[model samples]
Target: MAMFVHLTSAANAPRIRRSGIRAVGHGQGGARGVYCFPVLPSYTHTHQWLRELARFGSRGGLVAVHMRLDDTQEVLVGRYSDRARGAQSIVSASEAVRRIAALEDPRGWEVFVPRAIRPREVHRVRTAPQVAGWRYLPDAHGVRPCTCDGCRVRGGYGSRRLRERLPHPLDGPPPPVKVLLARVEAGDPGDPVALREALHWFGMRRRGPLSRLSRLAHHPDPGVREALVWAVGRWSTPGVAELLDGLAGDPDPDVREAVEVVRDPE
Candidate 1:
């Protein structure tokens, strides 16, 4: 058997003790599953989700519901954003533990069992530290934080303070695709940071003029070319293939690597 821990609100303790943790969706468009982490040898690593989970405003208190599952039980495992990016993979319970343990930094990794966990499988429900893990993201300290609405919750903990402390180029709602494209088309493309932000926003939103974006393949700045690769990958329209093929052999290794990561899975 493999040990795992599910962090939840202490308010649900009674029902969880009686009927077990229910399989339900969390977050917008989240998959229905019981999220947990493999109870590794390191106590801190096992309970790394405590602080981040508490940010959701749990009532009563927070607790860690330790549970056990057979090594053969299958589950979904990947980075925290893998599900949203359509990149999560399936593996056995033991394999999931081994895979995460092998990572140098498994802070954002998670496992999802698709069904309900019976009360029998729950080892114990114990009080957990309210502050044990990274909030917002793992190791976010020292990095320039994004203040975009999508990235920062309007009233989330310390969100306003962080935005005031670190203003980013991509800090507000992004301009429309045409507006961004116009900025790139200007003879003097100002602010490389803003330019890159525009391209990345295009990629994320999956909009804009595909033909015009394709022309950026030969942009002078490698960073622009890399951002172009991001935008181009989001487009599945005509002419995108030719642009990607050209970018696959970019002189800069980073641009080529971006092409690999952004390319649609086969």
Candidate 2:
């Protein structure tokens, strides 16, 4: 009765369940459930489907993925869309698998535990980042940290649409840019996870304001600062080199090193 959306190559869903992997895969995906839908997950309309799996008639929904390798991999399961940008397809399933695997190999993807849903829900769909409680961490060593790629392609084509020059990543009936910006501006300095997510949203924006980057450049946490550098590089903006040049003097060695690598990629 659940929908098992398999985003990666192969993982032997039965083995995953027999071992009692505990709702680790996205939407409990990859399992050859009573009902399963195999589709390559993307940041586009995929997010809407993830939330309303039951609406799609699956008892629950799951998107099993791995970060990069197709070897023996684990995937980003049920994980919710980005709080700020919703969900965009950026990081590949394998990319996420490798990142999580790094934290706790094989069971690395277990880090993202989604809300449990039953088969008979008649109304209301669900999404991730429940305002508070637990959160997903985007590792420092990630290529495109989050798996949402739709936004990475600049919402549609180019970075952003000219008519809709909004701060938030392109979303239907989008939230006010100010509100999205506030999430970053007012994020907890001590929580690198929160700050990095904010920086990520800004970088993902096609028409995002550049000031957001500078404002968070000297964030209290070095990890957040490092994230800021990554966001800049990821966004591929106009004066990226100039901006990174300024960050050369950043106090954190990691931040400076990131600038160097991003400035001249091999």
Candidate 3:
């Protein structure tokens, strides 16, 4: 699922382009498509740009607007299988506008990126050197972090199963479990897929049987803490109660609620 911003009018291009790009939840169904544009890289720039994007969406003008979150759920890598690719280069916003507007099917997934949109790969090279930590992510295919929309959206540790019993007499989390935990524990906090799946593993007691992840209860992201709350019941040890006690004071209401609901579902 690549990001596609439909220029409402030719005039909106320059203003929208000033807002830098980042992917959050969005889709094209309700005009909620991702609207990342060419802009200077700075924290303040993103903060201001988001305001502009939302403002344009309100008036329903040529400026960047919102899209349905559901439509942009799946992020895919490489050329999309079903949708046709946009032109190699669209010289002017007018041409891009004409081409997309002239499309045989305006409701399709095709996107027209007008200029050199820097790839996400550039950030990884500069910020994160190769480390053993990345091995846990589901994308075993390659080393570099995949920027494909599909790859981005693929979360939850790949399995929903509660647990898989160990085969040998030795008592240690199998390598696979270790990797899953690594992915959940060390993964991008913004993406919580693996963290969710890892919680399920813990909920099944495979976590205790294999290993314990004490740090999970204190994960900085509230989403991870909530998942841990739901899984606390599965800790076959006395620590479950203590963990729940600690979580009762959690800052996020959602996390506290998960603890309460999971503790006493009746």
Candidate 4:
């Protein structure tokens, strides 16, 4: 019993006048009903619709308008129009989504507003004081006493400065994959090195060589899948688009919602 109407130019003004009156009666008759009206694609058209709706005085009516914006930044507003009443303008789509998640209705509708796009300008800044000259520490052996807390704790002033040889080539233990997985999952913003390493290992190109490891991205474990989604957004790799497209159809709504966030224009 729900009805949807698309409005555009002033040329359709007469048609809206006829339809708006009918929608109120129609909505009141149905147990649960919606009257969706999408506007044509132009800012001028959208503005006109708002003006007309206000003029019609359909303030308490159940009629809703839809606004469409094109890539060129044109806005189109559509609605059922009745001279007897004006329609309420709903909240924007982004706000509506949040309200919906909170189990609340965002009863009004507004047109999409395109934000101004500007190019980023990079300016170099000095590195943090903590690691500013850290590279020189390894070669400070004998030349300077080790002031490191570790050296003091062990009661050995410069023991850490003494260079140690690498373990025998074949004697070193391989890295623990589970630990690596856990580190990636943690995704602590404080640890850029760990984040980068995890991204490299699980990413499409590098992961291609590690087929079994990459399969963990689509693992049955919710934690693993969630981490994979986060990694994909963090990395923002080219192939990630295809992966997200696939996830858009996932049976799990959470996964689909995550994918939608990355795909959204805003």
Candidate 5:
């Protein structure tokens, strides 16, 4: 889970350090382990440095490569559990090198290039609002949102199924009709009812055929007209392109915006 790198300006320090290296490990309770490296004079060659580390043994401890991704570096742990039997093929540093080098291959995950690690630092902070529109849920969903506090609360499940329904477009099947029927029936030309209906239909039978409802794109109501643009965007029907293109120049700004949203989601 942790990686440590040593850097020194001396050209021959690594070579001198590598000559008398030893593999050490813990004994019983909370004992320490140490391992030395056979370094070479100035790792001017990358492959040589990698080979030296590959040959260095770790006795029976874990071996891993610390990889760097965008803003984080990952420690990929190797699997090596046995030590007492001297099972030569069970684990080796060469295996770790092969895994680490594989990371650089295009077919494999990319390797971590060397970079400086920033020092750990701390800063003060404060809390802020967690989510948007949670306070207005009762008004939005036409039902009370959960208001139970942690203290003195009771919980129970209701077996009853609350089947609230909403209106469907005249060209299609009925949907879960809602109390907003009155508003939808009498709302202005820019009302969002038709868009809401299309969204409902889109959510319900997404796999159903669309050839029959294609005519709804020419509905007299701008809301219905705009909804058709959005529906075509959602369904991605090639036949509705002409209708959406016409609505792109609708006099109503809302309808025009809907047209644009459908035409260019970017």
Candidate 6:
């Protein structure tokens, strides 16, 4: 068997011990599965996901669920960053274990099992140190992070502190929906950067009159068209759905991709 460790909220320990870990995906691409690290010989490396998982764990303290899989079981493996971008490869469980174990530094490697781990496959569930691993990424301690609107999370833990320390060019509280609407309505149609920034604010606020952004649905710039999809997709106002449906088959691949993400923002 190839051993694996899954870090999850401790509040889920009881249910996990009873029914095993359910498959769920995170990040933009929405690849649903059970994410885990192969149980390496180094104890610290084996539990490397503790801290990162805790940031998103709403149930408080976390627990490590040690599990096992048949050596030949197929699973997806890739760099932690690659998984978010939908880049990964299918390999046998033993192969994944062997590959990571051979790496002198396997800090960012991740494995995903597409199905639920059966109760029998769960070896043990134990509480994990809440601060055992890195946040953002490994060796990212002193690096200055990008504070751009797209790079920074709005309501993430410690986000306020980060914003105070490293303000972005476009950083600040979001403006009223009406103000954003005026920016879009009065802004230059040909300047994609300005148009997209206005649309980005609309998406962040997740509110606005859909008709205000209707003109950009067929914008010449792909980025502007993509921004339009994101901004309008966040609203549930009538007509918004119909407008998105129209862009569902946009000529630009990026615009079409944005439509898929907006429609299935899991």
Tell me the tens digit of each residue's lDDT in model 2 across 130-237: 122111232324443223333223443333443244333433334466765777767445466866766665655554566655766767788877877877774545
lDDT of 3: 0.41
Which segments of model 1 are wrong by more than 4 Å?
A: 26-30, 148-266
- RMSD to the true structure for each prediction, in A, is 12.9, 17.1, 18.2, 23.4, 25.3, 6.6
Q: Give lDDT per model, in order.
A: 0.77, 0.42, 0.41, 0.35, 0.34, 0.78
Q: How well does each candidate superpose onto the true structure, as a TM-score?
A: 0.58, 0.35, 0.31, 0.25, 0.27, 0.63
Better of 1 and 6 by TM-score: 6
Model 6 per-residue lDDT at 133: 72
TM-score of 6: 0.63
User: Which prediction has more favorable lDDT, 2 or 3?
Assistant: 2
lDDT of 3 by residue, 1-266 (tens): 22233223334334434553323222232222233322213223212233323322222333333221223233321112232342233234333334444444332223333222233311211111111111223234466433221232222342222112322222223346566666665744535667777675555442363225557676788888888876665455667778888888999988886776555331
Worst 10 residues of 3 by lDDT: 124-133
Q: For model 5, how does the per-residue alpha-carbon lDDT over 113-223 read when each residue is reduced to its tens digit?
A: 122222231011112111211221213356632322111111212201111122223422334334223334443443455546644455232233345454555556666
Best by TM-score: 6
Q: Per-residue lDDT of 92-186 in model 4, one digit per residue for the tens?
A: 43443333234322123333222321111111111111111112222344564333221222223333343123222332222356766676556
Error of 5 at 246 (Å): 2.3
After superposition, candidate 5 runs with Cα above 4 Å error: 1-199, 203-209
Where model 3 places Cα greater than 4 Å from the true spot, the runs are: 1-175, 187-191, 206-211
lDDT against true structure, model 2: 0.42
Score residue 192 of candidate 2 by CA lDDT: 69
- In terms of lDDT, model 4 sits at 0.35
lDDT of 1 by residue, 102-196 (tens): 98888888998978899999999999878688876898888866776456654577866777676556654456777888877766545567777
Candidate 5 yields a Cα-based lDDT of 0.34
The per-residue C-alpha lDDT of model 5 at residue 114 equals 24
